[model samples]
Target: VAFAGVMFHLMIGSVYAWSVFTNPIAKQNGWAESSVALAFSIAIFFLGMSAAFMGKVVEKIGPRLTGTIASFLYGTGTIMTGWAIHQNSIWLLYLSYGVIGGLGLGAGYVTPVSTIIKWFPDKRGLATGLAIMGFGFAAMLTGPVAQQLMASVGLEQTFYLLGTFYFVIMLLAAQFIVRPNLALSSITENSISQKKGTRLTRGPELTANQALKTKSFTFLWIM
Candidate 1:
């Protein structure tokens, strides 16, 4: 599950490589730099906004389905961006790569982190760190790979190919990802004594409404 989560994140994190496409797109379309840049900004804004609500969706539907949907939306968005570019329609690019793709990015980003934490309760910090690290690492390779693809196949074709690649990889990875059964009897029994020296404490789990009523939540929001 952890490995699958990492693989999913690696593809979604290609969003970080948006900058690589900016110059090429702007040059090809005779677009002002700011206009071209707005696509990336819009995608990022939607990514954040969607994540806030998608967590509940994931909780309801499970990670596998959420991830599969994410792959579809994201992959389709990427392919649509190619069509948008070919047609010289910036608004379509925003609709495809910004709204649709951003929604997928949000869902894909959250599902794995949440699921992996459940699977590695004993080392949740480590699990989350490793999972998120895939996002950062994605930027490393995608920039160069996208650059090469753009040079070889042109920008539109690059989007088409990369979209297909992401769709397949994320779809396959999603099939192997499942939420851990945190309430399993064996898990509870084994975890009870695992961390002997640590000052472990348990408390009532808070619902969203209850959590919002707390000072900590208010302070964190302010911060």
Candidate 2:
């Protein structure tokens, strides 16, 4: 599951390669670079906003469903990006890449992070770091490849090819991102219980109003 999550992250991380398309898109449309760059900004803005909601969505539907949906949205959005450019419509470009693609980015980005933590409850930090590591390293892998694709096939075609490729890879990766069953979970829980002492202590539960006054909440707010 962790490996699959990593592969999924690597495929979606292509968002960081947006700059590779900026100049080519700008030149093709005779638009100002700043104007074209706004698409990346919008994509990022929606990426953050959509992710906030999609995390909860993943919790309810599981990573496999969310990831599959992400593959479709991102892939279709990329193909739409090509059409947007071909039509020379900046508004359509923003809608395709910024809105649609950003939604996919949010779902794909959060799915692995949240799901991996569940899979490795005893080593949550390590699991999260391992899954997200691919995301962090994605640009280094995607940038040169995107540059070469543009050079060989021109601008729009690159989007088409990459969109198709990402769709397939992400779909396959999503298949392995399943939630572990109760039998396996119980075994891990038993190990953790043995290590932490047979009996576990529970912290006092707090409601929203009560939690607001806690030192931990204050520190979290400050952070």
Candidate 3:
């Protein structure tokens, strides 16, 4: 499940590979590089915007549903984007890749982070790094794969193929994600707490309200 989340995130990072598509898409369609760049920027804008909304949604519905929906939307958007390119409809391209696909990217981004945190309360930093590390390296893998696919299949078919691949991998990841049992969690927490002094606090703990009210928290959030 965690790895699924990682894959979802890595694919989102794969957007960095979009630049590879730019010269090809532009040469084929006669679109300006600046214009294509705008589309990419819009997609990134929506990715961040949609993530803010999806974060709460993930908490409510859980990673499985979130991952499934993200995969479907992202996959569909990629296929639609390919069709849009074939038809030379910039509006359709933006609507599919920039809006719909961006939404999926955002939802998938949060899924694994929340899940990994829940699974490894004691090693949150490690869990977070594990979940997010793929994002940093995604471009390395996706860039060449996308280039090869575009070269062999053409842009339209490449989108279709990549979309299908993302759909399968993301869906599989979501399916394997299981919520850790809270009973086991309590037992572990209790055992760890016993090892500490009379104070039962597990590391540093704070209520959400308390955290939000803190100057450092507010500063960090602002930063």
> For residues 31-72, could you state the per-residue lDDT of candidate 3 as single tens digits?
887776666777788878888778788778877898899889
Candidate 1 local Cα displacement, residue 2, angstroms: 0.7
The alpha-carbon deviation from the true structure for residue 58 of candidate 3, after best TM-score superposition, in angstroms, is 1.6
Q: State every prediction's TM-score relative to the real structure.
A: 0.92, 0.91, 0.89
Structure candidate 3, residue pairs in collision: none
lDDT score at residue 41, model 3, on the 0-100 scale? 79
Native-to-model Cα distance after best TM-score fit, residue 144 in candidate 2, in Å: 0.5
lDDT of 1 by residue, 1-223 (tens): 9999999999999999999999899899888778878988888898899889988988899999999999998898898999999999999999999999998899889989888887776788999899899988999889999999998999999999999999999999999778866676356546655647544567889998999999999999999
Q: Cα miss at 148, model 1 (Å)?
A: 0.3
What would you estimate as the lDDT of candidate 1?
A: 0.89
What is the TM-score of candidate 3? 0.89
Clashes, model 3: 0
